[model samples]
Target: MTTKMVFAQPQPVLDARESDEWTSGICDCCDNKPQCCFAFWCCPCFACVKTRKYGQCLCLPLLDIFGPAHPATLAMRVSMRHRYGIKGTICKDCAIATFCTACAWCQMAREMDSRAIPIALVGTRPTQ
Candidate 1:
């Protein structure tokens, strides 16, 4: 007599639809008042701070000033949408980055906060 063993694969417990949208609207500045105020008062600094929190170089957003179009903001928005699986297109991202740059940065910051994604601070050593 010969015996064979069978293994079962695990399946997801929930079939609930994953959210393919941003946690807050681009103009939902009231969702995060402090961040919105900061962005409103000094957009460049706010963008740089938010970019650093997103684990990129602290000065990455400053590059936006050199171009007529907000390249840094658009790139960051596209990257964030892709990373979070948010449903949006490049054209939309470009338009928002161009027309509502401050709001775009604020929305990105709120998304990062809501998702609770871990951020590694620069020059900080890990403890064993």
Candidate 2:
């Protein structure tokens, strides 16, 4: 009987500091007037839609009522930035969530739209 020892090579690590910029500015809601109006007319509804599109439960946006520093919003912001490799810091996420929650959501939605990432396709995988 012969025993063989195999060595595994280390995988290359990408630089986390190299990140892309956001597709749209937080306050660029006017760029998409319909979505801007929808978000403005019924922010809660817009938030709910955004939450559901994020692959979370539709009611997750209800967490916003807990306070200005909303957990759901912060989590979504952080995840979106990470997923898209967008350049941002936790402090920036906190500021956006605390002060510009609606605009932030709108910007995220716009970013996804610009990227052609179907809202229905997120969190879903093709089955063989």
Candidate 3:
């Protein structure tokens, strides 16, 4: 079945091309790709997302909001972490994390609390 994306009228006037400023993002669980309507956010692609699923959950910091990985995801991850002077894996174990299962790396780190200096800013709310 096709999911229809919806949008609400903006409370404030918005640039007609306002969407242009936003990167296209579908939840990891979303099967719908840009091949279908964008700006039409449906519920998180629940069926599409799975726990411990590879290639889900990670978002581009400083670029888009909670969104899917982009084509430049690898570069983005490296550069963003570097920008933050964020060395080492954000996940627990201070383990080195390669690109795949980026979310898992972070998830495990959170669960173990083995995260290194400056807990990973990804995954959970900042620890108080």
Candidate 4:
């Protein structure tokens, strides 16, 4: 007797367009005014909030201040790009994280917000 094994094919989670490029530009803060304003006024707080939203520890972004390389920002940006299948190079991510830290955080925030999926819970009603 011979036995055969079959594997299921993987399906994409996000739409095709989402995988092509960033939803907004690094400097397109106008795409999300409130996020931009918050990022501008309190960058650390904004970074912390965005970091938490990305499923990282709330204090993750605070580590960026200790090092000149802004490691936290670079990591977040690279992770986001990879998760979303956005086309970008690590060198570009490093440059953005190093030079435009606030804009980078804001761009990530906007991308996450745009791709957010709402969850709906269903409960059975009690009989009268």
- Put down candidate 4 lDDT per residue, 1-128, tens digits, no spaces: 55554476444354445456988888799987988999999999999998998899999999998978899999999999888888999999999999999999999999988888765555645434
Q: Which candidate is the best by lDDT?
A: 1
Candidate 2 lDDT over residue span 1-128, tens digit each = 56555477445554343439998899999999999988878877998987787678999878888775777778888988888888899998988888888898899888767665322323534334
Backbone N/Cα/C clashes per model: 0, 0, 5, 0
- Candidate 2 vs candidate 3, lDDT winner: 2
| Model 3 quality (TM-score) | 0.20
lDDT against true structure, model 3: 0.30
Models 1 onward score TM values of 0.77, 0.73, 0.20, 0.80
lDDT of each: 0.88, 0.80, 0.30, 0.87
For candidate 1, lDDT tens digit of each residue in 80-115? 998888999999999999999999999999888888
Q: Which candidate, 2 or 4, would have the higher TM-score against the true structure?
A: 4
Ranking by lDDT: 1, 4, 2, 3
> Which of 1 and 2 is the better model by lDDT?
1
* lDDT, candidate 4, at 101: 94
Expressed as tens digits, the lDDT of each residue in 1-128 for candidate 3 is 56654475335432232221112111231333341222124212311222113234433222222344423334434433443344444442122223333342233222222222332333434323
Q: With candidate 2 superimposed using the best TM-score fit, by how many Å does residue 100's alpha carbon deviate from the native?
A: 0.8
